[model samples]
Target chain A: MAKELLKGNVAMAEAAVRAGCEAYFGYPITPQTELLEHMAARMPELGRAFVQAESEVAAINMVYGAACTGKRVMTTSSSPGVSLMMEGISYIAGTEVPMVLIDVMRGGPGLGNIAPAQGDYTQMVHGGGHGDYKTIVLAPASVQEAIDLTALAFDLADKYRAIVVVLADGSLGQMMEPAELPEMQPLKKQLPDWAITGEPGRDRRLLTSIYLQPEDEETTNIRLQRRWMEIEANEVRYQEYFLDDAEIVLVGFGTAGRVALSAIRHARAEGIKVGLFRPVSLSPFPAEALRLVARKAKAMLVVEMNAGQMLNDVRLVTQGACPVDFYGRMGGVVPLPDEILSEIMRLARFTPHDLNGHTRAAWLDRLEVVRGAK
Target chain B: MVATDIQNAKLVYERPESLADVATHYCPGCTHGTAHRLVAEVLDEMGIREHSIGVASVGCSVFSYNYFDMDFVQAAHGRAPAMATGVKRVFPDRTVFTYQGDGDLASIGMAEIMHAAARGENITVIFINNAIYGMTGGQMAPTTLPGMKTTSSPRGRDVETQGYPIRMSEILATLDGVSYVVRRSLHNPAEIRKSKKAIRYAFETQQRGLGFSMVELLSSCPTNWGMTPLDSLTFIEDKMVPAFPLGDYKVIDAVKSMKWKEG
Candidate 1:
């Protein structure tokens, strides 16, 4: 299909439809409402199911129900709404049902603002609800990436019979950009053997998350751990840019990662050897790939819209191979590219005469001239 | 010799084929076992057991799947209605139902049940209002009578503080989408027969493609009520009935004109 200008939320919604989503149930929350609205309008025309649920809790359970039928199902929400959905999400995970969830993250701890923020890194990658279960987390950095990852999420969810979450910030949800949409996929005509289709001449199927016996529960936990280990081995995805022979690496994901790319370009122009390492999957966390990058770099700078939640993951993977520094802007504040550039320069140990033999004062004068031209 | 003579004479009171042969974990004298048998018998009679899916809610009936002998899914606490809505919508040809308790349906899951009914989901709901949380050990439930004492309300439920009991049947009947809404008791043989009829009606409403249908049964929890199995039945008759009246709160014209086939 030809490239079309679309909002991030709309692109993701269209991508899900193209991926053959059979049902969508979601409650409206800011920064993510467009996705629900689009699904509400399109699903019925395609002879699919759509429900603007009473609440996020109800929406996610509806997804659980449809997923029990071995069909593609989804729900989207923001921070507080996602909190309400934790119970249902955990149930879906424990039952090993496959579904997709989109969390267009906003500022939080409470009813925070509807502005963009990456405060849900811990909640999404780590187990937010009460259990030893993990959902596949995909962080998209642009409108096109959002479309691509949303489609991939369905496949991953079904491949492992686990939930897949597309974690986008408010800016990624609200911003408009040109994207090439994927071709529509045909819906599955046959139900899987594990699905509860109420058909005769087959053994009855039961989809449940409860295990009353102590030994049974322990077995369930062990099974989940094994599945997670497999995911860690096979599903780790990350993007490396200009990392060959670089001394300083900037680590970020989602919108923060996109911003850091610009900082890396500007620093490179100023004779600084800085590169970018972006994680595409946050759950099976691209830990091994990050360790590789950490091995080559002398220093790493982690930037985020929140107060360094992903920083902890970076530190763990790096394991003091090199020093890791964090620069963050929280409470809905998005860090500017210049701020990240300055942090990268400081972490790389750049001095006055480091920028192509020009002093700091001369480099500042050149930047002012470039700004005037713009 | 008596058993042989009875077996040779006639097969009159055999268990329903839809009811599994496994033993249930229900407490002695609890009506959940009875409720399960009623539903299973209805499914057997309607000849829909092979094509019916059940959703078991959290609470005393959480393990209802073990006794249903059909495809079943367990839902999170209070989310059975939402889950049933999903199942019914995806496979409209299959009969779907939810088995929920007062705590699971009327308390924590109030929003889910209300919206499912309002949307006119083509599903049946069997709500067991036992006045107290049985599985959780005698805590107060939404259907707990104003002055009824529970472990959480040791001082005899204060109506001023805890509020009044909810009449779910009446509340759900007000929705335009609901095609059948009834309240029946399971304390006596006569009421048990009537409850069976109501449950069958609820299932028929779903099979006929009518809107949402629900039958609320006022049940007993003898172990938690601090009474004998026999006394708990009496308590349901003398005390529970007055608080939660028994009758059809909502019956559409289609349901009233319909005739039921005998099994």
Candidate 2:
């Protein structure tokens, strides 16, 4: 395989087309417009439809329509555009149509600057759209991971028949790295019989969230829960670095995870015996795997780009098994490896004997205050 | 029985098998029945029952889909054009069109309708300009005439307080993408024949793969207009036609030259 240097945004767009994306629709938004422009310039050449919609609302609806035809499709946007897309996202989830959404997150509660921020961690992982639904969120740490994980997103979407979100930040989208492109399988000409192609040779098919009757709504929720359980059981993905006989663990995802790797190496060089537990899938979050790893470590320090967003997931999985502590930087700035290493050193003071006094249960009690609020 | 007899009569211009044989819920002498018959007859004539997809918008005629023997999707207020654009783009081989009233198309969905035409999307739009919000108890509409009185504008519309009626056909004709734009009224036999010609043009344009085409039919809401069916027709001819003049505003017929090609 020949290697080519590609920006994270370009790599993601190529992966989508290689994954058999038949249509691409998006509006230009900061920190992610490169992906839209690339598709606009490339999709026409590939004989695929590409539309620069009037607004984020229009772009997502175009995706919704294209997806309903059972074609592989996708859309890209940043935080503000993603917010506008939530309405259509909710509708897509309700109808159980599988597609890809890439949110290259920028900062803020409103019009935040065009810099990398992991502030949307909670929104992507915790069902930001209005409904009882979950998007399979994959957080890529580098430009290479951007390509690999985006290809994986298409497979996961088709396998589970659900939305797969590739959540990255400006650093990952704008940064350049060498990538080995993966070949896609041949595309399907005809959709599955289940698709609503005008009720021909079958009864009328309805794709809507509105269930006037209570029982019908209950049945839909139950079906969604069953699918969620299957995904949790079989599809949780994560990466562990230098975990043999470590006393401390640094937990993170996305760009923060890349920073934590350096902090883990620095802690090891100082004989601090710290490891990294980086989650690759943020939705079916590696909860059980983290719980088992928690038994081996004396403490876990979660370094994040936001004010303790992923900390909630850390607490949920660990149940305070190893005295989970959070080190965070809010808004658009990313924390440095030195800062994370200092936090690890600050957390490594506890001996195994220290676990005997406070206990994991007591630490869990303290963590729940924020967890419950979230 | 009257509806069934109308469906059977060739002089009445309807498709018995392709149209839902069930009786219409529309009030007696209302033009909604005529509009529905015209659409059904066109579908039958074109032999596109299998390929046509209808978009029903939020209005008194929202249930128009129930009477059409074809696939249908109901859209939110003023969103039929957008949804129809989606369907047509997804299935380029299939014919997709939206059936919308004045309140749905001209008022709430003005932006979507205008943009869809401007984009020159390959879809047909059947716009029924009844000049009133029929589903919501006769409110003033964008197509409602100046000095028109209704439940909302009870004291008669004032040019200062209320804006003048919008001419959608003229507005759409100014677009680069729209291949055909025509406005016709369904007041008398002669005008109904003209409206049919406009509708047939839109349907044929779709079949021949033309760019965006729209036929704006000036219809009547007799129940909301507080007039008998005969008087409502007179009102449409006397009042609505002059405000929304009858004519074909645009026709491109260059759809074949605009084919998608991979570089």
Candidate 3:
């Protein structure tokens, strides 16, 4: 099929529907509301389930319940709404049912503005809810990547019986771009053996998160940890640009990553040996690939819409192989390519031989300068 | 006895096939076991056991999945109503119900239950209102009587300060989406029978596509009440029934016209 102009939220909703999502339960929140609106209009026409829940708590539980029936189910929300959903998210993870969630991230910490931000990196990539569980986090920088990753989210969820999150920012959720959608997949007819369908000719199934026993709970944790190992081994995805013999590397994901790509191109045009590394899968993050890049580069600059969340992950993987500097825009601020281009230019000029770990002082100085100018 | 020997014997009384053979963890004299038995017998009578799914909520009823011999999932505290909505929407043909306690249904979960009923979801709900959070060791509940004493309300629930107890059945009845909503007691054999009938009606409401239906059973928690099992039953009859009252709170025309099932 030919590519058509599509908005990010609408494109993701369509991608989820085509990927055989049988049910959608959502509450209206800024940035991600368009995705829920699209589902509300389309799911019923296709004879599937769509429910507008009372809150994010209800939405995620509804997704949990629908998921237990061996159906493709999902919900979309923004930062504060996803925060409200953490309780149900932990329960869903505890139940070990497969479901999809889309976080169209906005500014955060609390009730932040509804603009582009990447503040949920730690929540999605690491543990947010209680327990030792792993969620597959996918960061899509553009409308096309959102479509592709949204489709893949369902497959990976089913393949592992885990939650898969499409972690996009407000800008990607609101922007329109030309993209080709995948062919619609037929919904699955056979329920998985572990599904709670309550149908005849099969033994009844019970799916619960409660173990009530320390030993039994340990076993459940062990199972989740074991499943996570297989995921880390097989599902590491990233894109490298102009990294051959480059001394300065730039790291980012989602909108920040997309912006960094532009900065890398501009710096390269100015005769700077700068490259870009964009991580798509943030949980089973492409650590091995970054290690290789760090081995060659003298310095790396991490850019984000938040104040250095994913930068920590990059620093961890790089492990002093290179000095990792950071530049970010927070609280609904979207950085321009030139802002990152300058950060690259700064890092290219001063190749720090030691770890640049005290980022707060530097970050505060920049924030103060900007606030003073305002 | 062997299968042949048992066939000749009278099967006057036995556990319902829908009820699991294992023992329940409910405290002695607690009416949750009785409530479970009534529901299992109702499911057996309807012959929907093979296609029934139960969502167990947090509290004393959280482990209800272990007592029902069918597909079951345990929900987070107070979210069973939303979970039941999801299950019912997915498998409309399957029998779906949530077993929740006072805290799970009337207090923290009020929004979920109210919305599910307002949406007229085609699902049944078995709400056990013991007036206290039994599993949490007797904290005051939304259904707790104004003067009833609990762990949290040791000085007795002061109506002037703590506010009055909520009548969920009465509140839910006002919603246009509900087809059947009623309050029943399990304090005696007669009331227990009545409660069972109400449960059957609730499930029938779902099977007939009549939208949401619920039966709020005033139950007893002997340990939490600090009384003997017998006294706890009397407490429900003497204190709870008078405070909460009982009767059909809501019944649509179709539900009222249906013949009562005695089986």
Give fnat for candidates 1, 2 and onward, in order.
0.83, 0.22, 0.83
- For model 2, the DockQ equals 0.31
2 or 3, which is superior by lDDT? Answer: 3
What is the i-RMS of every prediction? 0.6, 2.4, 0.7
- The lowest-lDDT stretch of 10 consecutive residues in candidate 2 chain B is B254-263
What is the lDDT for A6 in model 2? 91
lDDT of 3 by residue, A172-248 (tens): 99999999999999999888899999888778899999999999999999999999999999988998888896899
The candidate that wins on TM-score is: 3
Q: Give the clashing pairs for model 3.
A: none
Of the candidates numbered 1 and 2, which has the greater DockQ value?
Answer: 1
Q: Write the per-residue lDDT of candidate 3 for residues B94-207, one digit (tens) a residue.
A: 999999998999888999999999999999999999989998899999988888899898999998888889999999999999999999999999999999989999999888
CA displacement after TM-score superposition, residue A263 of candidate 3 (Å): 1.2
B1-263 per-residue lDDT for model 1 (tens digits) = 89888778966687787788999999899899899999999999999998999999999899999999899999999999999988877888999999999999999999999999999999999999999999989999988887788999998789889988999999999999899999999999999999999999999999889889999999999999999989999999999999899999999999888787696
Residue B72 displacement (Å), model 3: 0.3
Residue A92, candidate 1: Cα error in Å is 0.8
Docking class of 1: high
Q: Write the per-residue lDDT of candidate 2 for residues A1-374, one digit (tens) a residue.
A: 57899988988998888888888889999899889988988888877888888877777777776666677889999998998888778877876777899999988768988989998988888977888999999999988788888888887887877899999999999989887888865676778655546645554444445554789988988998899999999889999998888888889999999999988888899998888999999989998899999988888878888877888778778775777777766678787888787677767764433444343355346445434654
